[model samples]
Target: MSDYQPKILSGGEHRSDDEIMADYGVSEDSPLVIMELLQRFHVKDIMRSRNIISLTRENTLREAKELMRDNKISGLPILEGKRLFGMVSMNQIIKALEGGWLDDPCQQHMSTSLVVLEEDIPVSIALKYFHNYTFGRFPVLNKEHEFVGILSQRDITSALLKELTSEISKLEGKTEAAVVEQRPVENVKSEWVIPYYSLRQFVIVRNDLANAGKAANEIKRMLKEAGVNSKIVRKVAVAAYELEINVCIHSLGGSLTIVLDTHKVTIIAKDNGPGIKDVDWACQDGTSTANDWIRSMGFGAGMGLSNCKRVADTFNIKSVVPTGTTVICEFNLSA
Candidate 1:
């Protein structure tokens, strides 16, 4: 056996909730429509499940380096009979070459402090991880803890960009006059609306992309069922979706509460920790701390907060650094 000590999470830090959220928070640049797309897809939808290049613990570091070079990948997971033991990154290869241990087994120097994504998580949450961490790729696992695939920023970006382009094309196909006519309905308020009431809460899991916009979709569906105006439903749905995504992407974990009364619909998204540093800055459109990878995936555009604010008749946000963030968006039902 090689004498090298395995390094913990050499690819990225095991960050605290506050640290992670503070590094990157809500943004307002990407179209709110893309928010739906982000929620529509999951990691399994875009992850590279086939032809995944991986290695065994007993594989030599020299072989790992050669595979990385040939494949132009920066990292490889070290497996022990389908179990993820650790990862071997390019940094480890350099150190091995320098230390004259290139022939050693991968288990001797692989990074064990790993960051992984669930196969079922929404692509939106995965995009956030790519923004927050420096790792070029993350190993994906199923609920059974079985390694299923590999998720790369490039693959996600390519897939989302294609969808975004297609969506944009559809939007552009509509005439300006048609769009202008639709705006009034979105802004309209009616005193003649039927009374509707409900209260519900949804658990928002940290990095749980698999169920990212479920709350919003549920809220939208419920409101429509309750006979709410289409315009009011759209606004409430947009707000709920943005906040829900924020909690999923930024918070350690939290809950989304939706209150529907006769007069208005209120959505409150509150998270546990990893809060924002500057609430004012975070609310600004096109202001985001998301890294290049996230931007490439059409997220971290700094429009999440702004998107919510733009549609809500009442909007309020309160945050404490390293603690958490709470945002409320209310849409008046009565004009």
Candidate 2:
């Protein structure tokens, strides 16, 4: 009567994780046999030989679709001369078919944008890039943006599993590094008023949402070192980032004010861009003017205003079309 259920997941060693299965159950010869099989076989060990199917900007969408069907390919790497430009696939073409009428250049239906990575870059880096864009494949590039080859989801997943197998072997040998114990989040009480020395006009022109988050984290670290606690810092971060993304997605750009005092915290964002035409509609969930690029990054969920409202005690948005928008939020520490 072991207290553990086999299907139940425990943090460390569940009833049957790799370590538990390897150390307690697997035959010594089994691991070696598996390793040999992986080395002798598996796509990860070999240079990928998948034929590179591609399209040009000038090609008609019909031609691209025909190539995909005739060749039994799911994706295509788009190119201009020898330079890797973007990528398109059957999925996007289907989406276009369902969403709108399509009779134009491949560039119109095609995703003429991509975030390429170096050929030698780690698969982990490629995976992160994949998270930001819903593309089936990517053109591998050299330093000069020259098309070297391409990477696919199939290759990336195989590499991940291969690395995983090595780790399983390490755990079998009892040579795994000791992991640091994690403390509970409740163990930490959020602090207020993170004092800062170099706090000035932080004009963060964030093109990427991830960069916006990073800038906020750096500011939090600065404030924490100055004696601010985690709670107040997170409020500032949420308010600051929502406003920042509002600028990145909808506005030109904006500056933030990180003013800290004994009683309150204020964050202000001002940007020049397409001001919200209808505040009531824009504030509704799932309402957004974000393009595919912005939507892919997990923004434009129409949650920005709601998020700000939840975190900031006072939230305000004022805008004029063809002019600019201003979002002001404040948190009261005294409460």
The root-mean-square deviation over C-alpha atoms between each candidate and the true structure, in angstroms, is: 15.0, 20.4
TM-score of each: 0.47, 0.41
**Model 1 regions more than 4 Å off:** 1-30, 176-335
Residues 1-335 of candidate 1: C-alpha lDDT, one tens digit per residue: 33322232222436653455344442444344555566668889888755678899889999999999999888998876556778999899999999999999998899987888888887767766886777888888777777777899888878888987775564454334333432323333432233445566777765545557887997899788888899999999998988887887667677788777778789999988889998999999998876444455556789999999999999999999788999988899884
Query: What C-alpha lDDT does candidate 2 achieve relative to the native structure?
Result: 0.59
Worst 10 residues of 2 by lDDT: 1-10
Q: Please name the candidate that would achieve the greatest TM-score relative to the true structure.
A: 1
lDDT of each: 0.76, 0.59
Give a tens-digit lDDT track for model 2, residues 208-320.
Answer: 34346654665576567656567977877887777777775576555555656566677777776667789888877778877544665577788887788888889888889
Clashes of 1: 15
Least accurate 10 contiguous residues by lDDT in model 1: 2-11
